[model samples]
Target: MKFSPHAWAKLIYLRDRGTTEVGGFGITDPGQPRFVKDIVLVSQSCTEITVAFDDTAVADFFDDQIDAGRHPEQFARIWIHTHPGRSAEPSGVDHETFARVFGNCDWAVMFILARNGATYAELKRTGNPHSEPLSVGIDFRDEFAGSNQAVWEGEYLRCVQAAPMPPIWDLDLLPGDEPYLSEQWPWLPI
Candidate 1:
C-alpha cells in the first residue's frame, strides 16, 4: 500500500528511537509484539497505519496526535514497536494482551521489526479470534546488497504456522530466480 507522508514520518520517528525491543497494547492485542512503522487517521477514523518505535512515550504521543484534532475521526490510536534480537512473532504475553484489548475496535494494525533488517506490518480484523493474514507489500532497495535488492522486495502475508527463529532466512545462494535457501520469510525482500 502507498503510505502518506505522515506514515513515513512515523517510521523514521520509530527508527530514531533506536531501541532494541519495543511493543504496544490498546483495545486490541496489547501484549502481541508489533513492530510499528507508521500510522494515519483520517477525520478520526482509523484507516491508515505506518510504523513507529516501541516506547512508553508512545501512549502520550498518540494521545497528543489525536488531541490535535487534525483528522476526520474524533478519536484514533496507532501502535508501533521494535524487535532488536528476536523474531517478530507474538510472544505469550502478546497473545494475552491481544485477547484482552481487541474488543475495543473493529480493526487494528500491528507492525514487527525484524532485528536491524526489515519490518513487517499486519492489518488485524477484529471479531473472530482466528483470522487470515492481510498481505502488505513494500519497496526497499540497498545498493550494498547487490541484485538481491529487488529480489527482497515484494508482498508479505501473515504466516499461519508457529513463529520461526531469527536470521529468518539463510543468505547462502546459487545463481537462480528461486532462493537457494530452504526456508524464507514470505514478506522478506527477494
Candidate 2:
C-alpha cells in the first residue's frame, strides 16, 4: 500500500480517541499500487479499550462517494484503526468486522497502526473465503509526503474564500431555499 505522506502523518500522529482506537476512511487508487490519497477521519465515541464505526453513516458516505463518480476502489478499501500498544496485530473483533464489512470488495486491506507509529497490514481478496489474510507492504515516500503538505496548504487557502454551508438536517430544506416548505420539498426523507 502506498499513501500520500499526509495520510500517513494523520494515521501516525493523530489519535483523537485519546488512549483508545480511532479510525477513518482510506481513500486510495481503485487499482494497483493502491496509493492512498487521503484520510477522512470518522468520529468515535470511545475510550481506552474499544471502538466501532457509525456503520450506517460510513456506508452512506461511501454510497455518496460512489454516486459522485469516485470508483469503488476508492471507496474506503482499507480499514484503519490504531492500537494503544506496540502490537499492530488485529484482535478478534477486528478480524470479524473486516470480514463482515469489507468482504464484498474486489480486495480488502487493513492497517493496524500501533501507538508508537509501528504498522502492520494485511490484504484479503474476495472469493478466497477460507484463505489467510496476506501481508502487504506500506510505502511512505518522503517526496510524496512533501507533495501532500503542499496540497494541504493549497486546500486550506482555497477554503478561506469559500462560503460555509448552512446547517439543517432531517428536512427537505436546502441552502438556497427561502420558502422552506413550498411544494412539499421534493425529495424523500432519510
Q: State which candidate has the highest TM-score.
A: 2
Query: What is the lDDT for 79 in model 1?
Result: 38
Ten-residue stretch with the least lDDT total in model 2: 170-179
Best by lDDT: 2
Tens digit of lDDT per residue, candidate 1, span 1-190?
2233333444334333433233333221223222222342111111001122223344554577557653312123333444443355543333444445544656665555445445555555666666445444432431222222121111011101112233423322211123312132344455
lDDT tens per residue, model 2, 29-101: 6565367777665544433324556566567777778887887778667777776655566655567778788
Error of 2 at 24 (Å): 1.2
| Deviation from truth (RMSD, Å), model 2 | 14.7
Instruction: State residue 118's C-alpha deviation in candidate 1, in Å.
Output: 4.0
Off by over 4 Å in 1: 1-13, 16-19, 23-63, 70-77, 138-190
Instruction: Estimate the Cα RMSD of every predicted model relative to the unseen true structure.
Output: 14.5, 14.7
